[model samples]
Target: MQDKTTLYSLRKTIGILGLALPILLLVTHQDLLSSMSHYYYTAGGVFFILILSAFGLILLNYRGYPKQEGESFSDRLITTVAGICILVTVLIPTKSENPLGTLFFTDYPYLFGHESNGFLGAIHLLSAASFFFLLGYMSFYKFVLNHDASASKNRLFRRSGIIVWASVGALIIIFAIEKILKINMDEVFPAYTFWLEWVAVYAFAVAWLVKGKIHKDFEKMIKTFQTEKSLKKH
Candidate 1:
């Protein structure tokens, strides 16, 4: 029971961090960037790195529910891959030409703008894509491994998985269109990547929160409060 509680707590924390990250970035620095990764060039860079680092570390350490009979993959192995990929995204910042705020690593040769190193940017992009794909797989398949097809939570996991993949698809299409047309879509709808990324993260967060049994905890707290109140009245 204690082990289960600890795991639930960890899930809840991950969900809360995911849900709060974008809001925190926007609040800390009102000026939005072209993508969430662009926030690395902003004052919110610290928060961006810190939160993602936390995510990577936690996932690397996470030992998900014990594998049921005949399972092919362990949750820990998949999460470890996701963790490493997310860290790669962090270590290799996205390609950007402009600095959004007081830049960190003053002496570190910067990767910025059109003239930035293509190889590093490619690495970051690939790592990020891999991370999201793994997340989608976990939500769509791994999370439902032990559940009945009609389970409510399984349904939620499937929906979240779809949303994650859909967001990834939209992002890929946008990037392809921009590259082929030599267009800057950010001018038309500023920070489009940030919004789409938020949708994917939000879906992941919601599914995790449900898996953590947050609703049950909330109801239990309410019931305890009501019981105490009734006792006091009598």
Candidate 2:
């Protein structure tokens, strides 16, 4: 059997990738996220990040099934819906790029703006929203609700859940203000809501990391597991 440390290391890497992916999106520096739409579907890094995030969520789902009463069906359904949202979120391009522009190689028809994207962008937005909201809901309500863990671990889960839900609230407020005032999100915020998005994604990443104990110093645990494995070999 693989040691605890190695398993945690893998989980930690996935969590960090989930957290860092949006920050990578921040570096694109394009004039319009609404226009460019996550640096275009052709951007390999962005695309990879989505796939990684979706897979990570799937991993989390597998880890989430608890032997608790009355939690199984709802948890499974929610996780399934969230995973589907993530998948669709990845498959649906945020917006297309102009054939005459830098992203022409993507070969998708050019969509100059949100209006240009039209129905497709709407679906993308819905999927993205569902993904975030569902993850936050799962964190705040379901995760650790049944897992009998120590006080400190439960506290960690609670704090992570709070952060995840807080991000969702912040996004709602930001969008509400933008729409109510009829101003662009970029004009109101430094990174044009990217940081808002980042917090949500980071929260999603972090809650799973806590659940998986990915950040724990697993030396003692690993040693114990190794000792038990060697005894079994006899």
Candidate 3:
């Protein structure tokens, strides 16, 4: 029971971080970058790095539910891989065409600049893609495991998963079109990448928050506060 509570709390924390990430970046830096990854070049770079690093550490340490019979890959393993990939995304900055702030580490010895280290940028993109794919997979498949398909929570999970997957697809399509046609969608859409990434992040957040039973936790907290107030009055 205690372990279950701990897991729920951890899920809630992760969800909160996911939900707050974009908003925090927007507020702190007051500038919307082309993509969330581009925030690495802004003042929000610290938040971007620290939050993602925290995610990596938490997922790495996460034990997840015990493995059932015949289960090939446990939740811990999937999450660990996700964690590693997210860390890679952070450590290897994306191709920063337009830096918003002081270009921090744009000139690192051998691991910076798209012109100098294009391969590193490729690794960052690949790692980021893998990370988000795993997140969608977990939200869609693993979270709904052992639950009735008709269950409201399961439905919510599926919907969120679909949104995440769709966002990823849209991003891919946009990238392909821009690469082939040599036209920047952001020219007209203005930060389309950031918006799509925000949607995917928030969708993941919603699924995890629901999985954490955050609603029930909030209700319980409210009741506890009310009970304390009544006791004091009495």
Cα lDDT computed for each candidate against the true fold: 0.81, 0.60, 0.82
**Which scores higher on TM-score, 1 or 2?**
1
**Candidate topping lDDT:** 3
TM per candidate comes to 0.88, 0.69, 0.89
Give a tens-digit lDDT track for model 1, residues 54-164. 889988888896666787767888888999999999989887743333344434554442226689888888888888888888888887875443488899999998999
Which clashing pairs does model 3 show? none
Q: Please list the residue runs of candidate 2 whose C-alpha ends up more than 4 Å from where it truly belongs after superposition.
A: 1-14, 26-37, 41-53, 56-63, 70-73, 96-115, 216-234
lDDT of 3 by residue, 1-234 (tens): 129788888788889999999998888788767888877776787788898988888788877876667777788888899999999999888887754333444555424435335788779888988888888888887888854434888888888888998998998999899989999888778888889989999999998888888998889999999999999999
Off by over 4 Å in 1: 66-72, 98-115, 148-150
Candidate 3: deviation at residue 37, Å? 1.1
Q: Per-residue lDDT for 3-47 in model 2, tens only?
A: 545545544655677776754544543333433235544354354
CA deviation > 4 Å runs, candidate 3: 69-72, 99-116, 148-150
RMSD of each: 3.2, 6.7, 2.8
lDDT of model 3, residue 61: 80
